[model samples]
Target: MTATTTVTTTATTSAAAAVTGVGVVLPGLNEPGGLRHGPVAGADPVDPAALIGKKGLRFKDRATQLGLCMAAAALTDAGLLGPRGLLVPGDRVGVVVSSNLGNADTVCRAVATIAEENTGALSPMDTPNASSNIIASEIAIRFGLRGPNLTVCNGVTSGLDALRWARLTLRSGRADHMVVAGVEPDNDVTRRLTGARMVDGGAAVVVSRTDAAGAAAPRVLLGPSFRTEKLPDCVAALADAVPGPAREAAAGLWLGPDPSAVPPGGETADLSGWGDCSGALGLLHCATAVAWADSGRTEPVYALLGGAGGEASGTVWIPVERAA
Candidate 1:
């Protein structure tokens, strides 16, 4: 018999991160009417040139290109960038990216070149993309987000973990706004590693202090809380941190990398339609919840992610008034 896992949601006392804007680069999400229904079948893949233009894309890998485009759209949506450049000082912004297989193709190819041909055979232009922090660094460098730049490579929980870090950074007064993105590229290397076709794009969001958001922008309070625990202990541990609302009121919907373990009971949605998003699913979860709240859904939603080693991470999102 297969072992089953149970998931639940509760509140925490930490300060919430306000979502000011969102952007998605997935096949269907970027298209007209795409936000209403995410990741439709046979949708066209993201055209980096179309969204962000052709300059500076030559040396960047597919994942980095997609991530840059997604971040640009999100930043533009948040009104962070103006005609000249960033409205806020470059030193006040930060970037956080999460991807399990991002740039894997570039890294693997570089390694193969070193093994088969010679170290000199590796192109200098491609060498930088092999670094683990390439995507995050590129985003910061291009957009002048000179604050704190980080990339999350944690397995399935990387997406939520990235968001958790962003919240902490804001509360600690590190940066005013955190540009968070989760991305994965459809490529031969990633496909072979995961044994499936990969999603060619990802999602992004602009999160900041509640007071920093515009008065009329659609907003939601993201948990300042994040817990990594075993499956059974997750609910109890999170529920005990801070308590006030009913379970249903706290999280009317639950989303994660693996909802199959959630049992056939509560409302749940699968991420497969987005393709093998892997680490990008958590960010997508936040974007989807924001869309729901934008459409006038009031109750909070939960995104709980469990990793391969029985470790889990989760956060709560409560929709607020448009003025919030």
Candidate 2:
């Protein structure tokens, strides 16, 4: 989402913010890494080293690998990963990633390894990957992104929060292009808390300022949080927020795991098919909304994310109109 002004109470921007490139790695659909989807929950481990084509990644943890794969995919899809260099200058681009459980299994195993062996045997490489913010740093290092790098470890709302931050960063001219990503891995901690095996996935999208939509790409969407409003309020806000062709889509879309968390009376997409994605669901919603808009059935689509915590994170996409 682009801002018209500084992200004050009523934010605006000189140019509209648009989602130019999108990448999503879903459960059982491993596009980044060549790992097959395991039966049921515990999928075969993904070796992202092969996907990333980097030698030093052997020591990095799974979450970090997942984050890299999604960021690379988004950059690739955006044509930013050209043979020459990044689409934008390294210093002009930023990376923001969010996750609920960051390095859970890594810390658990690190302790087990130290206990089983000793301090001398403990690997120094593993220590750096244990932090929650390592994912963004790793991506920046790999791509030489010298702009702002942020990692959010908040709960379910973290993904949305990351997107919000990216919006502000662009509005403030800190970066010309921002890659916003969200990834969640399956682990013991999440399984015990959710009582179900987590469906691991990573989703990423590139947000930038542009005057027109990419003809082959999906229209860039900008949201004013119409998704968070009540059905009546959402509908009313959407009337002003959406263009003529897509106003109805805003009124008809419903997203979230909890029915009570959102206003009633819209076509609720079945998220059960995704199993348990944990906090990555918020990013998934953003990517899905963009893809759905690409399908020509919708534009400037709106989506709402609700967690078991009963809190809602709503987002809107305002599609960039094609140049005449």
Candidate 3:
């Protein structure tokens, strides 16, 4: 049951990608009804039922499962649930995977097998998951999508950068629809590498041309202005590039090691619940924004992400009219 949306404002860039559907898999809030934010606890995110086809999950690893499930949820939410959510033609749909340390456990397992025996010892089924790009490849193969597939390996703001890239891809006339995912599956390897309260699931968003904004209004307008940089610098940069909306009760994000210092004139979404989802954080932030906007109690939502070395990224969300 996809909600109807309507965009009131005229197109700003005329080629920006409109976020038609958003799916977030935070184990912390895997309720039956819909995705929502909750208090932060040292816990793993639970996957939804029937998240993917049995064949798809047959030989895939946990990282693959997380990504597949999120992609399904996003596509379904977008009202594109045609034979595993491939409503558009294959080539017109692209997939971009963003992650800090994508599928580390799979890579480590391959390396260990190689060290123990030899290259021949590595399982062919396990080898594909080792590559970060496999996440995107899996989505393409699952939904019969033949569009350009890419993987972005930035830092914590990988998801944000991926969204920017997806929008650019649409503007370039590369694809009619784009699926961008930022995934971080829980595993011992990730726990050791990063001491954050790793959530087991990830997040995905269905992107299309701004003309499709009405499909899922409360549109998150991503354009050339949305970018990843440093914290205060990125915030200041966004202020210069795109000014804040004229809505009251606006929401903003100030994410980092310590996100205590809120921005000057906007509100920040609570990221305490999902823990350090790493690559998945940006999409989680987006889910929070969409949920907040579509919840009747509308407000302007802004996504602000800060990474290591003072890197930051941001996006603007306007809940013009979201279905209840």
> How does each model score on TM-score?
0.88, 0.79, 0.82
Candidate order by TM-score, decreasing, is 1, 3, 2
lDDT of 1 at 70: 88
Q: RMSD to the native, candidate 2? A: 6.1
Residue 3 lDDT in candidate 3: 46
Tens digits of lDDT, candidate 1, 56-118: 899999999999998987888888976677888778789999999999999899989999999
Clashing pairs in 1: none
Q: Where does candidate 1 stray beyond 4 Å?
A: 1-11, 31-38, 213-218, 236-251, 257-266
Best by lDDT: 1
**Per-residue accuracy of model 2 over 233-277 as CA lDDT, tens digit each:** 433443355456555534545555344433334455545455566
lDDT, candidate 1, at 11: 34
Q: What lDDT does model 1 reach?
A: 0.77
Which structure is stronger by TM-score: 1 or 3? 1
Each candidate: RMSD to true structure? 4.1, 6.1, 7.6
Q: Over the stretch 30-115, how does candidate 3's per-residue lDDT look in tens digits?
A: 42124344543565456434555466586677767778888887877777666635555677778988877668888888889889
Clashing pairs in 2: 2-17, 3-12, 3-13, 4-12, 4-13, 5-12, 5-13, 221-318, 222-318
lDDT for every model?
A: 0.77, 0.65, 0.65
Worst 10 residues of 3 by lDDT: 5-14
